[model samples]
Target: MKISRIVLASVLMVPGVVLAGENARDHFRDEARAATGELASELMQALQAAMQEGGPPEAIAVCRDRAPAIKTRLSLERGWRVSRVGTRVRNPLLGMPDAWERRGLAEFQARHADGEAYADMEKVEQVVEDGQRFNRYLRPIPLQGQCLACHGDRDQMSADIRGILDDRYPHDQAHGYQAGELRGAFTIKAPVD
Candidate 1:
């Protein structure tokens, strides 16, 4: 009778456990989106200011130097691992998404190719690694008019900007992009209890 009761209790708790997991996933997704938006806004503003003050070269500096600093600070403050990664990378330091991020980016690309709005492209998953569960979220980053000054057509780019990019990133693969194209993605990971 005791064994039967324990079995019944476990069966009854399954639904609640599943529901809790779903709720946790949703909560983490929302949190990731909010944090990503804030970080993107701050970075964009800083890049805009840098561009206005100098030019695309200065903006590159903002991306190369300031962006990592912002990611680090935000990660510490928000208790999440935050980063930007791309299929083609400009900075080697942050180049190449992990396996999970690669899958998310592929999905985003497929959705975009299927005519889905770039703004609507996102992926959130609960993954287990080393017996610990994590909530991983990714949102597409579409190229903008400002980004074209650096990441656009090679021939159209100013000589100074090209030179700077080549010098700073010897193996840069992040170019030849157009506005409205998927530039990369913001990826966030947070541990889940």
Candidate 2:
């Protein structure tokens, strides 16, 4: 969900401070939303195609190989850091949340616990890291019905799917998710101008 300019302006406003480039920050947030939406839609299309052609095992390969490629392509095209982070990661190299992301995930979880719909959850902020400032955005990725083939309960998963996951991710922890649960988040960080 895109944050409204009125809400952003209200949040950034201070009693005696002059804020600058409010629209620039809003543009950055919109770009992040567009990139994240593209990645999610593309991955879903690919996953659905793979599932139809070769079932759950092929879908796993698509996520393992193609997902990272998609993220890399988006990062190059947008010149921003774009990736997914999971609460329980299947591939730690790609899906592990960093410290800042962990904090964002915690915030998401807390909001969800307080009855906020996951579909409407998002966080946007600016922070300085190592003398560089960035606009960071996070949105939760809710697990859908189709995701159950690989991400659902392991005990009920097919043997082929289990075998592939075991071979590829010896230390996987991304299963046991139900529909509508928080699978992970799409995170984007663009340098502030």
lDDT of all predictions, in order shown?
0.88, 0.90
Highest TM-score against the true fold, candidate: 1
Provide C-alpha RMSD values for all models, in order. 2.8, 7.7
Predicted candidate 2 versus true structure: per-residue lDDT over 132-177, tens digit per residue: 9999999999899999888899998999999999998998999999
RMSD of 1: 2.8
Over 61-119, each residue of candidate 1 has an lDDT whose tens digit, in order, gives 89988999989998999888998998678876786788898888888888888989989
RMSD of 2: 7.7
> 156 in model 1: Cα distance from truth in Å?
1.0
- Clash tally for model 1: 0
In model 1, where do residues sit more than 4 Å from their true spots? 1-15
